[model samples]
Target: MSQFSFLQSEFAPVYEHALKAESAALSDPRAACFYARLALETAVKWMYERDRALKSPYDTALSALIHEPSFRNVVGNALVTKARIIKDHGNRAVHDTRPVAQQAAVTALRELFHFSYWLVRTYAKGAKPEAGLQFSADALPKTAQVEATTLARLQALAKSFEEKTKAHEQAEAARLQTEQARAQLEAEIKLLQDEIAAVKKANQAAPDTHNYNEEQTRDAFIDLLLHEAGWPLDQARDREYPVRGMPNNAGEGFVDYVLWGDDGKPLALVEAKRTKRDARVGQQQAKLYADCLEKEFGRRPVIFYSNGYEHWIWDDAGYPPRGVQGFLKKDELMLLHQRRTGRKSLSATDVDSTIVERFYQTRAIRRIGEAFENDNQRKALLVMATGSGKTRTVIALIDQLMRANWVKRALFLADRVALVNQAAGAFKTHLPHVAPVNLITDRQAEGRVYVSTYPTMVGLIDDVQNGVRRFGPGHFDLIVIDEAHRSVYRKYRAIFEYFDSFLVGLTATPKDEVDRDTYSLFDLERGVPTDSYELDEAVTDGFLVPPKAVSVPLKFQREGIKYDDLSDDEKEAWDALEWSDDGQIPDRVDASAVNKWLFNADTVDKVL
Candidate 1:
């Protein structure tokens, strides 16, 4: 008997996928994982279609659908986490080339079983599945001499199942053609909705009995992140790698994960901890593992410690430990290791004057370089007035950083699409050698420099492609915020927090003029910016023309029009005009109400 046999009666459409997932668990781990995710997706979509209480999300992607507020509210946090695991694993099974482990497939099946149980208990009108039922791997059918299928074949199989499911649903709907049958179905759906509501209320009051297994979740999350970073964990030496020279009696330890380079040297090592524990708790342990690897291989590997929620990277040979959003890719880690010995001093690098000729612009670049190179600060704020060549200045800064090997990829964010397009043009014009892509026009475009509006970038932050995020936390080495102000702080601050990159905020508004604490966003003190070129300075330097103010006065606007002061012709015209329904002309009109309530073309001509 299949572990998901309970779902066969009430959710036949979902049961098909669940049963296939169980059948392929041992024979084809990848297919099993893929089917588990398919089952969850089908079940969630089924609920959203039938449940009137659940609001449909604009995005139908599995990640977006499950993370939608209404879905999260119904399933709660624990179930949401389980759904995420299944979705992520299934995505990797289909999109990634690494072979899926049997253990991972088992994990996916267990999570799907619990998730299915919750769905059936809440929504099924027939016999509800028992909550005490457990998913037994031994009960899954063992197949001998199963045929190996390609990923493309698996996708085709899933597509076929979707077609069949659709046809079955249409046929079922055809049977309810009679008005009486349709009415009975509607009544049944209404009753089911009411029952679901009551169940939700009761579940809210009851204590949660689900075993979260946070440690397992943490390891799975870390695995997903590493895979996204291009680490193929197919080799036996990739995980739980044994090492010697520990201080304990056994004089040995097993590293959580080891990332290897083509030259047979360890590029980096990761130490994973439980989700609730601080990642720093493994810092010393990670350092010790690095020491052992260095003693064995003659080269120290970059040490990274993570608890799934937070990650930290420490290149003990070069820089202090710093927080990162995810693991660095193999090429990125290799380049980082190379930079330790080959990096040039940024202070010694010259600013490309051809790109930014202004003295203040060059000075601003120098101050920013000093902050990063000497002060060890990761954020810098540049306050310059509009039309002061902020775009050109940043292009030059990026040029210098790239030339010095400080930045490999950079992202520039603007509040408006027009600004994104304008900045992209500026980068292309000045730094023609480097490729620049405007995310506003084409999100899939690849380039060394990415330009995007804040809102567009926010949506793309969590967007996963081919089981990996297109813009991982460590994707960009630097991020430039154009027109950085209170507006960015209010609606799109997540963009800055999500990426593990050096931040350089460019703002036209002065500190005192902005209502929110803009300085705090850049980690700078109030009234102090990393560099400033005010409007007065720009005008004094002849970069901008000074403004001239003039005041205009009109007769009726300056003084209220008094009936006593009006000429006989004007008074006759006023009397001819209707001021109110009561047909009463006022003795005088206020200056503020002259054009608002009463308009005279002759008075407007005088102002013009």
Candidate 2:
């Protein structure tokens, strides 16, 4: 006989279906729940037949069967409660359109199993019921108790999922509402643009001229360029932007207008002129304002200056300031900001490698150039041992930066006149196309490439500090320091601080005790150069000869010797030397006496 034979022929269908439900529980819990529901209904019907007085209508719900007094009195409230729970879950399984939750189904099935076990024991002819039986967890097997707890935990998870889904739907609705509001704002802006265009057309057609003042011109530009260009003129931009830079004769300065980005930082600046005045009238003021804003924003922004009629855009990274028909679209301005800030690093392909002579030199140029591009670093340090060709490597890097359009004009500084001349020679020979001006004699700071002695640069910085402001902060796109370990320290540091250019320091010994300050000046980590060719590596690569240490012990005493130890001939010579009145050796002492007193012929021969 089967192990479930206690579920007799009348209850066989309930037992068979319960077995199928158990088989499907893991892989297909929905099917298992449906089958479990069927088993519960069958068990309830079997109980109903046993007590004919507890007659349930043919269409009676599973809850009614459990609540019937005849059935309840026989099975007890505990068993009836389990039967009711199964009835509710089973109805959901068959009638609800939503798929049954695994936990819900598993929980209902667990309760049904316990109820079926009780029914089989109570109703089967050969079965025996334990006295005072109850459907409490303490009476269940360990595995069944554990599974019941797991089902409860899963039910909690399902509830959490439902809550999260509801939150997501609410967030999505809010997003759509925001988009609709944005669309309405855009439409209003479009209407404002049309009104401005109509006004401009009407003004041109009218015989009476409209002489708009500076403020009126400013307002017109705000409506025509900013509003029409989709900038929205919201909290992000500011008029009469307060900035402090190169002081005037009165020692006060501020920008006229500044454009701000969403990040609450300055993006660009506009220097407005009266409708009748030339836009170039404000260029010098705009340049000073740009320098001042760099302190607050950490990057110099795109520059624009305009009278009411003409607009001009300037990018220090690319070509000179030129007239544009109108302001660029807002998206184009953002892209220009990204490019100006060097958000992406340059690749090897971006560099012009033709001037680089060797593989290692090329590698150094690529790495340091990429580092500069990556961070838009203001200062970079490169250490190559003497004879390792630092000048050539730096030239290659500068060439690459210029070719990539990262640098427009460059300045090279050195401590001595000879070093400056040497650097100029190298630049002329290697980069023949680049005009290398001598800043010392020529008094010229303007050139694609300018070689200058540190003292000459000092004079220029003094002029700027005294308010003559000979060179603007953006005068040089890049500055290279040769023998940087010496030139960038002490009183010479002002030259570096005055310009807002990218600084590159080249040294033969960066990690030496005296050069540590130089390393720190370039912002290099301790003992690390941005690009390094160590003495040992240079020798290993055969760029330099390996130095050998040879020790030769000297027999002669370094300290002064007593006159008593001198030989007879030396003593005679020393005695013959004439003394002054104060007992000092006479300035008229003969060469023969001096040489003989210092060393005998035999001693001189031995040293030689």
Candidate 3:
């Protein structure tokens, strides 16, 4: 049964001290009769609510208990026996006109002490909520105030939780209502946009320099949208697109604009929102219409809707909705236009920040190339934020290496063991190789320009002890490490230094005081010929990926885990760790450690 844990913070001390006091002062000739009477009173309370009708009142306490229903609450036969004995003791001392012996009284007090002890033990063992929590049963006047405080606190917390839940439900309802309204407005906006577009297209197809109006502007925009979207605007005007449906495939659904791209044979279904707020907006409706038109034309139409005013684009219909994009006028487009959505030309500063600027103004390509100038020490470490394009960084580096041939062998190492294998596998897929690439695992330990676990080579020292081990030092030109703050990161440092290889470590987390050894790789102050290098140049050059730093705070129910200051047992384990003849721990020590023989009787099972 599930147990509700009561804190030792409140009731335990009172229980302990009260039991001690009772143990001390409660022993006297008269006390035996008092206890007996108390026991009889309890047994009688059981009689009033007869869940199981008793066969006879005179029956032994065992008979009454065994026949009782709530075995969980009352301890059946055993408790009944205790009650009977106490009643007998009371009769012998109090009512029989006999002087109670001191020993008899002391024995009775001792029994009371044991009963309290039993209650404590049962509580400590934990019990079900259905059984109810027992606290302050023997409460003194002094302790009642504190118990009341604890109860009050619990009540407040429950009330707070209920209030928060109710507030959240109300907020969610409001949000849902808001979303429905926005969708309705967006659809109305789309309809106005579509009508305007059809008008412009008619004028364009008509080949007349007609008087321009809102209708003409709309038609022009639709025609231009179709052309750019890769749909043949001329063909679309004549209803040339094909249509199909899923459940009912009788050409029920038509496609909009379907176009061929250099790669994706890319198809887009568009919904246009002409304005942010509009009545009866079915902008998506027109986009959907175009999508259907494309399907009818035997191609998936890249759908688009534009009001020549408000521009909202969706790639597909399935959404919250999804593929939602708002119109943002670029510097080229904003040279003259002025509105909340359209602004003046992008300033020189903004241009410098753009990705295109890195190629020209900042000489980003040149900066990357210069970092690789040194044959050995030219290894680079770039710190980019979370959203920063690390993939693009790797791609650019690969591109440089492939073109220049300054380096022969390249190995990319992700900080995670899982990522190491993943990256290597992904690399194999991305590149064309005449010879199969090697990544060491349990099955195979050797390969050209291998990617593998740091321990893969060291793990087999047992078999190697009797013979010569094959994998000594990898013959790679460059080794890059990702997520370098991990526990295994120190091992990589050892590899680059002792094994005489150029190293580059990459991480989303910057080096901090907590990880000094990790920071040693990218020593900022001295900037010596150490195995590490940090780049501020990439950011200056606009070549570095701009990252977003998002800090998500977590609140644990209790404080987070805090290990105690190192214990003697922990110190002993540290001292015991040693290399064997095989360069790994001896098998005996391994087995012993696995069993947790480091501590006590059950140590062996834990050591592993």
Candidate 4:
């Protein structure tokens, strides 16, 4: 291979000139010296560009470049001195118009070869450089393959860049179109604000007038907003429809207006009241009718209340009522329903039954999974004793949940690192084919199942709070907090609220303070367990060994002294033997007094 092949693309020109200088040394010393100077200039320029700190725009002197700290650090004094000698000799050949001696040219070529070798070793990384480089014409690259290969690579890069630029231009065009649409929407909002301001000004000027006809005002407001929202209000609405489940207090309470979808079923209920009443005044009545309508129909309709001048909308899906300028279109209401209900709809029957499960574990999974179906609850606690195979049971639960598609990702948290690692190991043992992610050292918790210590989660929470890392509240579908009693506390409470996922807390010590806090977190009543596999039941079922307590008594201190048993003088002496605040007798107590008044030394020694 050619010596130039060892150098990188950036140093290719220097390599080429050095090789040429070596070749021309004997036949033409002046030409050889000129090429050597070109080679040094190219090398210095490469070094300057590699470290931008070395670039001196004001000074272009070659001597100044050789003296630079960056250059000297890399090349060292020996190489720098040799470079100077070569530069001086090359300058004489070029400026003086004089021919250099064969010896001088050969020496310059040798030094240039050494510099090339050093550059290649430092920067080329993998290529091998010739150690015994000499002034030989035969060593120069004579083939055209290198030039052809470089040209082809450059052409490919240009094509790649052109494609990227076209894609960028398309994205820019789409962004501009979106910006224009936003600007138009902003203009419309401004117009609405101006109209509301004018009405407020008129109302303030004539507060006691109240001369507007309520029916006409209601019809006018509804008509204007419906037209703006692209709804045919006249055809889309049914007037005076009797609610199916509502009490007939006023001859079958009639709904003001029920908006229908394309399928001729109710999509929303709009309770229109007189302009004198507030919009919120109709909220309760609207909610009552919505419940009645939902019972009659399979799905609940969007609840809306309007007092002609203002309108508000409410959905039973936990979102509170909010005032809007206009009603939601039929299509918009359907989209909202889909988003709220279709988010996490997984059936228990979808679980894979091929995997084995303990009887207690199966029961726990059934109960907890059913509870997940309840819309009112989002958290639960599994109270299983320490040796009752909680980790194995949770792994089985996770497996079923994964199969049923209830949880796409889950976080397994523990207070201690060892417990977290143990849990991770249990998962690997049960699902040997699946790999678990370790969040403690990985900087990120990835994969379907993530295992982490509570401290690591705190760090992640800190990062998210400071805006250094961005993890959405709903990133994880489920969070299983192991030893939940210890993990959920005042200092780390934010970790629970930051995630909008279903929580399952597992703990052995779920009583007293822990039990109260756990219940409060899950919003459960006293003495109600979300899922319980108690120690007694586990022992009875042959799942754990029965625990036994042993008591031991000391012979010497079998019967300790009592204050009531002492004589009046002994009691006085004992009381006078003053002790510390902690109720420990002072060391200053007389030994003879202790032997005579207090217990014997043997008893005292045994107690100590």
* Cα lDDT, all candidates: 0.84, 0.63, 0.39, 0.64
What is the lDDT, from 0 to 100, of the residue 123 in candidate 1?
68
Give the better candidate number (3 or 4) by TM-score.
Answer: 4
User: What would you estimate as the lDDT of candidate 3?
Assistant: 0.39
Q: How far is candidate 1 from the true structure (C-alpha RMSD, Å)?
A: 9.6
Task: Write down the worst ten-residue block by lDDT for model 3.
Answer: 460-469
TM-score of 2: 0.40
Compose the digit string of candidate 4's lDDT tens values, residues 1-608.
44444554546778787766666666666667767877887788666654433545323446557655567765654466557556655554554323346666766665666566656554543444444443344554333332221223433543574487579768866765777776886676567555544543453353222222335435544543453344545652377777766656563477888877776667888898876678799998888888877777767888888876567877767556755545655656665566565544444353334443567777777777877775446677788888877777778778876666566678899888999889888877786554688787676545878889876775554232211123344456688988876335544555676565678878887443455666777767755778888887888998899888998954324454556667899778877775668777542434455455447677777887
Report residue 595 deviation for candidate 1 (angstroms): 12
TM-score of 3: 0.26
Preferred candidate (TM-score higher): 2 or 4: 2
RMSD over all Cα atoms, model 4: 30.8
Candidate 3's displacement at residue 167, Å, is 58
Superposed Cα deviation of residue 579, candidate 2 (Å): 11
All candidates: TM-score: 0.72, 0.40, 0.26, 0.38
Per-residue lDDT of 1-608 in model 3, one digit per residue for the tens?
Answer: 10112312222443333333233223334433444344334334323323222333322232243233343244433333334333434434433333445444443433333333333332333321222232221321222121211223433543574487579768866765877776886676567555544543443352322121333233334433342222443445223235444235464644333333333333344333333334126555655565554454544433435444334443342211211112211221121121222322211112213222233323333434444442223344544433344433443445344344333355555544777666665555544341224455533543334555554433321111111122222234456665656465544344453232335555555323225555456443322222221234345555464456998743321233122433678656644767555556332223334334345756655764
lDDT score, candidate 1, position 93: 79
Best by lDDT: 1
How displaced is residue 297 in candidate 1, in Å?
2.3
lDDT of 3 at 433: 48
By TM-score, highest first, what's the ranking?
Answer: 1, 2, 4, 3
Question: Lowest summed-lDDT stretch of 10 residues in model 4?
Answer: 462-471
